[model samples]
Target chain A: MTENSDTLGATEKEIMYATHHAMVKSGYAELSISRISDELDKAKSTIYHYYDSKDALLLDFLRFSIDRFESTVNTTIGAHPKGDLDHIILTLLPCQLKKEKRQLHCVLVNIMPHALDQEAFREQFTEIDNRLKTIIEKTVRRGVRTNVFRDVDPAQAAEHILAVIKGAMCTRLTTNREAATARARTSLFSYIDSHLMA
Target chain B: MTENSDTLGATEKEIMYATHHAMVKSGYAELSISRISDELDKAKSTIYHYYDSKDALLLDFLRFSIDRFESTVNTTIGAHPKGDLDHIILTLLPCQLKKEKRQLHCVLVNIMPHALDQEAFREQFTEIDNRLKTIIEKTVRRGVRTNVFRDVDPAQAAEHILAVIKGAMCTRLTTNREAATARARTSLFSYIDSHLMA
Candidate 1:
């Protein structure tokens, strides 16, 4: 799917976009190609021609999201490469709490439980989670090595950080309570200030 | 549902048990009264005698779960009244990670997103969450007053604790990654020591 992005035309982009919104609304099992095509005013064959199946389309969608996340993380880290952990962490939280990301977060949250039943989805998610973990792990390790963070095990600390963020993100998406969302986000800063800061 | 436990007969208990398992397996929309009755080897009328519809059944199930959780929390806190945070927190984590609780946790995790679409479910969940938060809030306030914990906002700390536990629980329920579950569970203990310990 990523091999020929340049070759992906406007219609293909539109199909992917509509497919994403459809998945957000309906989830994987409930996803309807016809509904997406209806939304786009195109035939289902348009999406079928680009991606053979719903799973195939979603797989590419997940990859696209991961690629986007990786790039965003890199850019955020690049802007704060000198170990401003608060800014880096803040960058992660607010975007998710915003109204626009709620649907996407909801869809992904649904995928978590379904992963227990579906092998393909589980594999894709595991791969994505592992990649994300590695990114956080590298950042924590660099922080420790540079003495910006106190003595701490990088892997364990990374898991904690990931847990807070993922846990917070999932909670934010699941519970629409603005207070809980803000509390989760702020607690991350509280956690870093209390534990990791030098 | 909670009133007059003595008034609830064998059939009511049986229906509640069956409905709980059905919700765990199929979620809210897919739940069928006939299927639940079939599981109990009874007529659909038998369930309808107790519940007018599926929503009514599920709502009672939610209340039943909350009541059970509240009693369980009280019993646990009573046992650890002096701020034995490890025991109190440990009580929260292991049960969900166990094989028996996975399906129940899955049902709850799924409810989180369904609430995003259904306002009634959202209200029900928010009420349940608020009650649960209050329990933690009171416990933390007592802990602080007794000097068992450092100075921290009880509400904020409760939110953090809830996030870590809920986040950890959702992650544990969704993924069969023994490593991820183990890491998330391990991270919770690490969180309490770093944040709540005086």
Candidate 2:
């Protein structure tokens, strides 16, 4: 699959956009090609021509969403390692995404339960997670090189960071517990300060 | 609404058992009153006699599961503060659950997305989360009083600890990535050692 939306053909892009709107409106369980087609203002046959099933369409939507996040990272990431790390944290946490993209995060949250039983969906999620972890790992490595971070296992640090982000996202989105996420964010930064900072 | 399973009548307990099996077998999306009846080897009308809707039944099922967890914690929590904290941590984490209870956790994970749009479901989840957080907060407070732990904000510490547990649960369950959970567990214990240890 293409790494970013830059390489997607116009029709594929249209399909992805339709899928996003449909998922945000109807959620993943209720999402169907008919709903996506209605959003596309196109026929179901058109979606079938491109994707054999709704799962195929959703897999592409997952890629589309991740590519959008990659673009966000490209724009938001700074040369400063701490800034880069903080931006990444904010990006993953709920309520920080652009208003439009916030719905996309909800869609991802909706798809997570689906991944528990769907192997293809689970693999895509794993890939998305690994890519995010790698971004954090690289940032930690950069911080270590600059002497801003202590000598620590970058991979371990990345895992812990992403785990807390996932937790905060889940807690905030599912329970609407903003204070819990706030507390988690403080705890995470404190961990960085004590363990990762020099 | 009962705090534990002891208050549940025999029929209610039977319905809960049927629900556990049905949810584990079918997952939440496909769960139905009819399937639960099949598990009970009783008529669908019997289930409907007690609960008006599938959502109602599932809500009770959530309470049943939480009550089971409370029972486990009641038995497992030790007199020692550190042991109490560690037991709670292990209880919340994925792999450490009893074999039968693991499927129950999977059912909770499956039910999570349903909470996104359903108010009843969301309220139950929030209640469950609040209860767990309170347990952790109490544990931390006890630890601090006995000088086994530093004087940390018990609520903040509890939130952070639960967040990491949630992150580890999601990572392990969704991605099947044991190593990620392992790293998170280590990071979590390290956090406790540095921040909470007196």
Winning model by TM-score: 2
| Cα lDDT of model 2 by residue, B1-198, tens digit | 435557778998999999888876776667888888999999999888989987787778888888777667556556877888877776676446565666776777777877777777777777777878888899999999999999888998888888888878887767756588778888777778878989
Output the TM-score of candidate 2: 0.91
In the order shown, the chain A TM-scores of the predictions are 0.77, 0.88
Interface RMSD for candidate 2 relative to the native interface = 1.3
- Candidate with maximal DockQ: 2
Shift in Å, residue A39, candidate 1: 5.0
RMSD of each: 4.0, 2.5
Give the Cα error of residue A83 in candidate 1, in Å.
5.5
Pairs that collide in candidate 1 are: none
lDDT of 2 by residue, A1-198 (tens): 435557678998999998888877776667888888999999999889999987777778888888777667656557788888887776666435465665676777777876777887787778778888889999999999999998888998898888888887787767756587778888777778878888
* lDDT (Cα, 0-100) at A183 in candidate 2: 81
Give the interface RMSD of candidate 1: 2.1
Model 1: residue B20 alpha-carbon error in angstroms = 2.7
